[model samples]
Target: MTDQPAAESTTTITLHLWLDVVCPWCYIAKRRVQAAIGLFERPHDVTLVTRSWELHPDLQPGTGGPVDHDARVPGESVAPGEQRVRIEEAAVDHEIRFEWARAVRANTFDAHRLCALALELGGPALQSAMVERCFAAHFTEGLALDDHDVLQRISAEAGLDERRVAAVLASDDYAANVRADEEAGRRLGATRVPFLVANRTASASDLQSVEDYLGVLREVVTESA
Candidate 1:
């Protein structure tokens, strides 16, 4: 009788990230998580999933400008000027070029829809590239994410088919997927952008260091083992 080969064991860990295109913290959090993932032993076993979390869902597509600092952090004792300084200082630590003065606050629904399409058509690498471009466009370049032209350029830059991306932008393709992501985020009790869920076992919404992410990943691995 021929000897039978042993079955190969496989382990996969899903890291779900709920984020908004216009959120600066989400950009920072992404960088931190990426850095941590580089340090992980089983990086190939992990899959990063980006989910939609609209920060300003009610805002119109064309009506975009600098975000109202005071309006965002209501009831806080900190003055807007002081808050700006503090936020800029913190962003420097993450190597993020936060051009808040030129930042445009707009509806990110369409951008989220594009992300969903990226995942469907191009998989995680393309989705990740799309997410990074969206964040950079909003926070670094201070571009309006709601603009279809901008989205098209970003989509093309991320290696998506221009014709397909244009079709998606022209129609309501993947709109339901965007809404589903939002609903799932709500069910997970994620009220803030940059929220991360590791293996659906651990989660956090606040700004965390690379070590913090590593710790969470290690815990998930241990539990799965």
Candidate 2:
């Protein structure tokens, strides 16, 4: 028989990111990862899944003070203040604004639940919009994340159905999903937010630049081939 042509490649790389909505570094990491994906040759073949990991699950819903930059970060050696400064300086290149002065340390369970609902309702694209909106609501606008009204507005802005969002927020819908994501992160040896896993094999925790993230993505792609 005559030789047949090679079949087209259909490999898809799934990038799982476990992040907290209120964590500034998570926000930076998200932006950098997005930028890296954009620069990838086969961006369309990549799937980004945002997973929940609450930084302060025990803190009461409505009881958080101003951003405490001096607090110790779980995975990093530098103080949060210095980290924030470094992130802020780097974020300028990404056109991301960090309103550090206005940020608050709030419990993110409800927000994480909302993200889970987004994923359930509309898959990765919708979930990504919901995530970006939530991050901007907290980090840029300084909105109160613990407030249902604020979340409702943010959800509506993210293009999620208002009634569905209301139903999810009204009840404890998707709480289990949020918890499961955190459990998965813990099993993966994550002690902090922005724990990134590529194709369930390679992983990275300290991504300093867009190039760093791009390198990880390329490595995974090469290994898959």
Candidate 3:
């Protein structure tokens, strides 16, 4: 029998990001991932896919109103004040303007639906812009994500058609998509927001440094090559 040559392999890496819009750490993680990508040798070889993971899916909008500060902790007994301080320190270091004291508690299901719509109609860039706007609205502006007006404005800013956004908001357009993403995250054993899956192999949930992300990317690139 004749010997055959090995097939050529592609070096592109896919990063699956599971995040919740209302999760402060997810926002910081997004920034860290961007910084790490910036430092990668072949940044263009990476494809980022942001998936939905709601922190408070059952919380209704405009029901109990915004919390004075974020109260959810990751198996830690830190007081609210100390948590704010710790998060503020990290936010300042990343140049992210965070007003946790003024932040509002919101159900992010609608916002996630908008993101799914953006990804379907516009693509990843629009979806990314939509997610960014959602995070900024919740974490920085203290806007209620479940409010249709707030979502409309944010979606419009992200280049989505205002009327289409309104239609989707009125109906349960992408609820299944959001649920599917959450299901996938659960299947992958993600119990927290900002869970990152690199090249569908390595996964991390705890907040890590940009260098950590870079290391993961480099290892994936080397393995693929």
Clashes of each: 0, 0, 0
lDDT of 3 by residue, 1-225 (tens): 111212344477788889988887788888888888888777787777799998777787777465655465554677656777766766666778887656788888899999999999888778889999998888888888889999999899989999899999889899999999999999998998788888776677756678887877776755655
lDDT of 3: 0.80
Ranking by lDDT: 2, 3, 1
Q: Per-residue lDDT for 134 in model 1?
A: 90
Better of 2 and 3 by TM-score: 2
Model 2: which ten-residue window has the lowest total lDDT? Answer: 1-10
Model 3 pairs in collision: none
Give Cα distance to truth, residue 65, candidate 2, Å: 1.6
Q: Model 3 shows how many backbone clashes?
A: 0
Q: Which number leads on TM-score?
A: 2
Give the Cα lDDT of each candidate: 0.79, 0.82, 0.80
Task: Give one digit per residue, the lDDT tens place, for model 2 in 1-225.
Answer: 111212344567899999988887788788898888898777898889999998888999888888775555445577545767766775787777878788887888999999999998899999999999988988888887888999999999998899998998889889999989999988987877788898887787844567777777777766665
lDDT of 1 by residue, 1-225 (tens): 111212232557789989887776677778888877788776787888899989898998899777764434312467556766655654676677877777888899989988988898889889999998898888778789999999999889988889999999989999999889889888988877778898788787766777788777776766655
TM-score of each: 0.88, 0.90, 0.89
Query: Cα RMSD (Å) per model?
Result: 6.5, 5.0, 5.4
